[model samples]
Target: MTNDSSRASGNQVSWQKRLQDNFDKYIRLVLTLANNSSQASGNEITWQKRLQYKFDNFMSKGGMSVFLALVSVFITAFAVMTTARYVVERFFPNGPTKGTDDLLWEIFVQLIGLRDTGDEANFAAKFVGVITIFMGLVLFSSLVAFITQQFESRLELLRKGKSLVVEENHTLILGFGDRVVDIIKELVLANESESDAVVVILADKDKEEMDDFLRNNIAELKTTRVVTRNGPIANLSNLDKVGVKVAKSIIILNDSKSSDNEQFKTLSDARVVKGILAVVAANGEENLPPIIVELHSEQYRRLAQNIAPGAVTTLNEADILARILVQTSRSVGLARVYLNLVGFEGNEFYFYRSKSGWNNITFGQLPFHLLQAVPLGIRHGDGTLTLKTNKDYKLSKDDEAIVLAGDDSTIEFFPEPVVQHNRIGCVERNQTLELETENYLIIGWNSKTAIALEEYAKSVVKDSQVNLAVEVLTDEIKAEFENIAKAYPHIKMEVMQVNMDSLDQLKTLKPYKFNSISILAGSGENAEEIDAKTLTILLELRQFFKEYSAATKTKVTTNLIAEIIDSQNTDLVIKAGVKDFLLTNQFVSKILAQVSQEPDVMSIYEDLFSLDGSELYIKPIWLYFPANQIGKLTFADCILAAQNRDEVCIGVRISSQAQIKNKNFGIYLAPTLDKDFILTVYDALITLADDQN
Candidate 1:
């Protein structure tokens, strides 16, 4: 019995020693992982283990990562405490008060140390309890410190942004708003030519949430690496996180959401101005990278330029969109022309050094030399973009010809003569004098609706009429419309409040009489309702046009245009035989996308769209090409004829049902400079010329 007792005691002692060794090793392991960034030696570093190594490395780094490190420490301490108590109870069964696992509770509850409840064996409990109590206190204290530091680190990170970025020549996009996805997509396309491209986004949004949103929107981003930081982008201190100094370019978008109130919008614009100031200040005198900002008002845009001399290219996105809407409203294919000019997929503008053979040649003779490219303007050595310069204006040796070509590589001197290649026909030109009282009808209300109306008002003659009929709108929108009306006293403005869906209301307002009808995607609480309303109005208008044509026994040629929300729904409109529709919001996205790719492209658009310069026009084919002519007239013939008229003929738009897909919304841009096609009576020449020209 004595031998058995000795053996049992020896067994208990052996097991206790083993448990102590394991507990000590566990403590060492936990502390090693918490303190070290590398994996323990002799351990298999699987992908998971490698991930842990990376995670620990990240935690060791400065910024929010430090919080995770402290969290690791806290978790390790808790694990150590739990394991220690469990080991002590299992091995020291006799040393405890009873079979119940209550010693751990006592270790936690005990203030000073541990004591035994039973009087028979208080010594054993004292010896075992002292060491356990001390271990728990040390671990608990360390854990408390870790918890405190962890939260402190997190709060500090939230107050500031993440760590300073190390990227060089990266595009910095400030202010994440409605066009964020579109901007990113454009940047991605811009970077397609490069092997490695980086785009950093700094916005007043959660970084993780931004990441999730991007991932959701862009299922798979190709070569470009996108990084996001959470903080107020306009804040000067937060700007450093995006490495503004090394940025290739910085784009500041309007931050105000569509749902934001008028007061909030003003604040958002103020933030944009402040953000531009911050960027300029951050990079003092180091030749500040090209900064692009979108402000609402011309007053603010001019102010922004004054604030940052030669550094800011202020764009009024809403106003520019308003102009495009107005232009496209009257000209059927103007939207597609703008889209082609801005997108990277097709022909883009490139600045080319004038070839030696074409030296001292007149601008009129420029198109004959390069068969593939169409010269848009002369970008002088000093970078002055002169669009639609005088035909007699001679090209200087230092002139950089602005030629529209397929791509940068595709730009070269084509030796082939640019002549017409296809059989063509000519039709009688319908020549007329000044337009008779343009009656414009707008259906729906957007923030840009008033701007569109104001733009439209500028083109019409005195005593022209404008009718606005919207289903629903805010007081602010109405006030803006009224304000615009006051500016144009000659143009009679009329507002009709009625449900557009009601056929009787639609009948009361005869849309057929109007020279132009602009049906913007109707405003609604949701996109579905907006699209539904637009479709309904579109269908209703089609029915009215059909009926009006049948009753009058005359062809109704009222110019029709509609704004669509989704590009996919364009098919529905196409099926309805209403060929002209535009994605207005998407247009902004696409233009921003194009500009983000090549900043110089912005100059091309600026010149094309500016009111004081040459603009796109859908002039009749006979205006340049004489009527009663047979056989195909080549692009060269069109170019020479347009040059005579102080215009540049880029493409032709023919009324053909068979060539819908090939046509860019009824306009074709940069069709092989030599390619020729038959011209019909309804065909129009897409020209870039001043209105007076």
Candidate 2:
């Protein structure tokens, strides 16, 4: 490390020394030009040269020519119009005299007016007035029009998004991120019902850049007109420019690109909060729209909420992604289910007030009552959500049942028969205590590492051990681990320093022995680089598993899950038999986008994501199937069986080792109620029940 004096010596430089090094010759040349110009021209500048230089200087100012030309045209038009009015008055005294005010206004508007002047004209005076009007209009009107166009074009360049946005009750997105195009696409799907729905995005990026990015990504927007404005998201002027006050909902994207850096992420989060505050202030403590702001850290969620009390909601990306990873690491295809629900392109979460004489029934009877939708939970009028409602919980008329359906309009129940099971086969037995030791290898680290470890530890057995491997464990990383250890003592954490770039070193770890392997996205200068490193690590893991299995003469099997930053890179790691790919920003962005469309959906998101709440689980068929009931059972029987145990059977997961795109993953969500739902011993039933772990 350099001493303060040495650092000062390196930084400080006198102006004379700086000029002598690189700029002295150029400065002396300029000075010589000025001196020679003065001396050669009798030691004084000529009047013509002075005037020409002043005119050129004046012309160099932006819009100065347009201003001067408009002024000149205005003076010329005034002289021409005034002379025409005088000529008409003097030449035709008998002509009908109009007031000066009326005459001046008529002359000013006649330059661009389309109305015929023949009807108001009479003879020579009228003809002279019309001729004078034509002359001025022909010359000055064209000049003025050209000047106006040029000025407007200049203003359009400098004053970004200067036009007043007239959209009302539209969704407003306050920032731009890699997920913006996805959000816009989802909004387009959401706006398919209405012809005039608009999604106005206000970001710090250039308007043309945003528009081009969206156009390049999304081929067709259908009915949605997405308007982009380039300005500071936290600025009140920009908020008004995008019509935030009249917006129906707002999504504050934490587009803080460096999400791994704590200080930078927090600074970006502060900007989001400031933007929310500006919107709330603009709404005037009145009917503020539902604002969904994305914060990078959970510690700032409440801080943002306090900034704007009512209707201001926040989602912590790290915390939410950590929970999702922990949950999906155990159950394959569960992340797909979440992605489908949160994204508007597929079957999604819908809330409906049961008005068909079923409001007085218990929630357990909900599935049989709904059409093709399954009742996942209910929300009270007071804004409380019981996502996994108890079987005996009776819903009132004011309460709305949250259903997993194809569309919001299709949430009604159909009058169909609940097919009974013909033959009850033997079901699998349940294992109460998981005393078997499980090993987990966690590779790489990010802002979510500590939270993910804590959540993962909470879901694992008491003696379960976690082998953490990273390139370097700094004091900060150690501190994060200490915090996790203090929170979760059941998890035995071990740290290993290894170079992940070397495939041989990755093989030395023997990742297949672990019950599950998590390769987190490495934090670098940008998300693309981070994703590249993550992809590299994923390939190494793939090769490690393949070579190990080849050398040992065994079939390859391991629960591999990794975090992907960029959505475009998901395909690169898909062939590696990874159980789940957690596209962190894409999922959160979709949720925020979906919530912006329907504020009530936030409750569904909350109920589905909360850790302590009743969550969806992929329990082994042996755990749910009774001793006498197994094999090919109807989905209705599956539901009935789970209902008997006070649980809701949403779907089934058949293939344990499968990629996401493969329907062979055999994870059927919202399957037909009466269809034959075959449950093999290796398959698991996806049910909405208590967190069995």
Candidate 3:
């Protein structure tokens, strides 16, 4: 039992020694790791306190190592000294043999001298080892720092460039169309004060095509910044890459897909809307803004609205065609006049209440002699605004007045002594001269024809005449025309199978050199072939008109307007010298975007174009002024002129040479300081009161 107890004690001592050794090794390993990691982390390094911690660890482990090495060296020296002393005693216990004593003392003195030189060498070697170890640590640490900083620098660059990655307040406009240039032009006008306003366009087209278009056509966009990214709109990931969540608004363009017209529009717009909604949902509404959508059918409008409430949505084909029908039926230059009022280019619509002396005055009394500004119309609370109300219709205090030139700031004062106009001056006029009868010819037929015919009927007077020539006339459409033909016997309609491509056959109509012609899109399988055929027909028609006019010795005004379904193909027709080309595709998409935001805007527009007391007109502001004396008037002064004449000034068109300040890029509105007040033959459109009649 005693032997067993002793063995157990010995084992316990050995285990204790092993545990101490392990603890020491672990401390050393931890110190090494801490020092290496701290230096290698670079910018990610901890504070100075962590460095102090590492230094403390280094001192602990290093001191222990130095102490152990010193102990081993001391032990070796002590053992050697004892052995030398023992050998001396063994040879001569009492004293060194008398003869050997001298020899032993000499040897001992020589060894002592050698030991001093060895100690010097040992000190030098230890000093060199310490410096080498420190340098290796520094060199390794510095290499890690350089590699880490390089990686961090690249990350910093990426973070900085993320702003350019398309984010909030940036607008995304898709598709390429004839109206895109105009739409962008208006956006630049709208966002003039912003420093970093961005308009990014995503199109499945060559970047060069868009670049060339802007370079050649848009000179008005002087300083506007627009970026273009090329890709298909069908891909959700591609849309995400453009940074949809950061966008202020997304305008999904109609007619940018390859499929059936209605199906393609609905599908493509749906896809865009879905992608935007997904991103917005993931980003959260509090973070992501809204998107404006476009649709081809009235049926799809409801779906779009459901998907994104308050988003702009419209049936482009129907609304545009309806407007064309309404406006064209009015008169020539009427559409241009209407454009000034409703469009962003000219003067925008505004409301103000008449103050003081201007209060309670009839439309007739607010002319230039009394009020300093022109009174165009009034907008009511129910979203009804008239361009020109009746003359005797006295304006109340609550009435929202629409002015031609001035807004709320400049239209504050009313001149003293209300100016009155002579009633006799309003009536006594010479008999209206008889207008010469003119003939108009229309070619081609489609759904657009219905609107075109309605417009044509309204533009011409009852005394004027027109002839419609069509190929492939339908029985049902012909039946509808019978009722229209009954209303006007002079509107002769004839159908024939003659080919428009054949010049000889087209010459048979002899539509007079100066007659107007409109070419509408028709059913065709091959777009390129149809374009080629259409081009041939138009050239032949022009040639025939030129030769026939010269031979007949009759000069007539010929205006050609082409309706292109695809905006991308509009350039070909525009270059063909067509005076006016309307890309319905683009027009409809824009209308959707606008009405989606403010549906009542369309109502205001409709009222502007109506034939009631408020109607759009292009009466020269110069017509009402005295001979050659109207100075370069302020926007306030221009409004005064309208107020005096019972008219509304919507916009002003100046010559290319006119110099203006604070003008937006591609801006066609706002009069210049140096332009002559003399009314040019080419006039601008404003709203007029029927009371002037």
Candidate 4:
């Protein structure tokens, strides 16, 4: 029994030993499997992360980069399929052996979905064929989408006006404003004789918006082709894009919307200065074109000229408008004469340099030597203009005749003098009405008010009265008026706060008593609103005058001059019985355009508008022709008569045709010297003289 028990124990122990050995082996196999699984998982995760990072980076570079990446993937797929087919055919032979060219061609066709792998004996060849077909679908779809996106991107760039202009001798307008339409219209008229002319505009405005605005404003562009681009005017790249280097002329317009605000005007002037600098920098100093800039402040105007000396021509709008207002207020038909003189639609000033016949000719006789033009001044070789010179002054060799003609081509110097002796009537002496102290009325106010008042002080006789009326009376305005009054002690100045809306209040001032009434545009409003207010006041004044004249049966001869901000509203005002009105923006724009074409004319305008120089006046017809010969004399006779008085007969104003709009309000400028006119005693002669007398 003991022997049996010991044997059973040994057997159990051996069995237990065998069980432990099997369990150890199982544990070792389990750890080995876990280790292998972990390493394989780590490798797969690393590979996935690398692919993700590369894809993200490629996508972040934008659509073009993504498109290029897709193209690369397509090429890689094609290469892989081709190589795989080659390998399968060489290492593992297919059903039929194909040449290298045939193999590559077949792979390409399959990848593009043009063909399928038919009856391929090799399994590897079939697998690669299917993969290539799938990749082709994905890659081609992505490529189409990317190509469409690229096309859209290109269209967007075009809409933004990012393309450069390829033009030469074109007019480059650096900014846009209310004056742009007028400038362009004038340019169109100026370029009517040319076959093709371009006016490229670069402004901080939408290209489409500018195009639409211009299309609506200008009825016909004639021969001028307008191109618009959107960008900062002061940017060098933008200036280059507009072809600044090859430009014939450059006009920098002041921000008309900001003209009333000092801060905004300063910023606008700074931008103009920067734009001028940009133009000069873009096109070297030697290659700089004639640059015309309109600046509100005189300081900036001087600065602009100092920067580029002879290359820059600056315009002071306030000064010019003020002078024109004062001069226009002094006469009844002077505004029409100015309108006829400064624009391209009518008689324009041109510099005529004769080859030989004009040498040593007297200024008075030069008019007879010209066919259709009137000699107004002489532009010397030194660039000095002598306007309304003495008839006895002789022409110099370097002098260029500054004549007013309907067209430049019509300005011809005839070798023989043309004079109609029969139509030349004797100069008649007429009594002139003189008033030592004049009464003037100024309604509303603007930046031009003080300057106009100063001009009045210099122009009017001693003890002349000026009554300034306004809707709102602020200390600033009062102070400005006081300063002006202090400076001009010769004139009696009166300031009153009157609501222009109240006709009764306006009547209380006895506006009919004033010799001349000037209406100025108000501030703090857009041009349309300001013009509306001005038009309203004008209608009110006209109504009051009509009623007063009818009620008292007394003829009211008050000369009314209104300031019109928009040229579109000029016709409305004119129809409202405003014989004389200043189209502010159009007037300035005409001057700018004319000066850009001929910078020397600016001096002529400056002199013509100033008080110290010779000015335009409408004198009684009897002063130029005898009362008996009023209806029988020709325009040439009138010219000869004016020459006797040391004056220039530029035009005539007929009372019978005064209300006729188509007849130029009865004002004829640079009329044919032999054209006969049936004039009455009431009609007047338009002449340029040293004084009204």
Candidate 1 per-residue C-alpha lDDT over 435-473 given as tens digits, one digit per residue, 9 for 90 to 100 = 567788988776567877887788878898888987765
In model 4, which range of ten residues has the least summed lDDT? 423-432
The model with the greatest TM-score is 4
Tens digit per residue, CA lDDT, model 2, 580-663: 778876787788888886777876666667678788777677666654466778776677666655677877677643453767
How well does candidate 3 match the true structure in TM-score terms?
0.56
Residue 454's lDDT within candidate 4 is 87
For the record, the alpha-carbon RMSD of candidate 1 to the native fold, in angstroms, is 18.3
Q: Give the alpha carbon lDDT tens digit for every residue of 352-424 in model 3.
A: 6655535567754444322434556666656567666666787666676665432223453354433332222
Model 2 clash number: 11
Cα lDDT tens digits, model 4, 219-271, are 99888899889999988888888899899999998885422867888888888
RMSD (Cα, Å) for all candidates, in order, is 18.3, 17.8, 17.1, 7.1
Q: Which rank order by TM-score, best down to worst? A: 4, 2, 1, 3
CA lDDT of each prediction against the hidden true structure: 0.71, 0.74, 0.53, 0.85
Each model's TM-score? 0.71, 0.78, 0.56, 0.84
What TM value does model 2 have?
0.78
Ranking by lDDT: 4, 2, 1, 3
Can you tell me which runs of candidate 2 are displaced by over 4 Å?
A: 1-138, 141-159, 414-435, 486-490, 626-631, 660-664
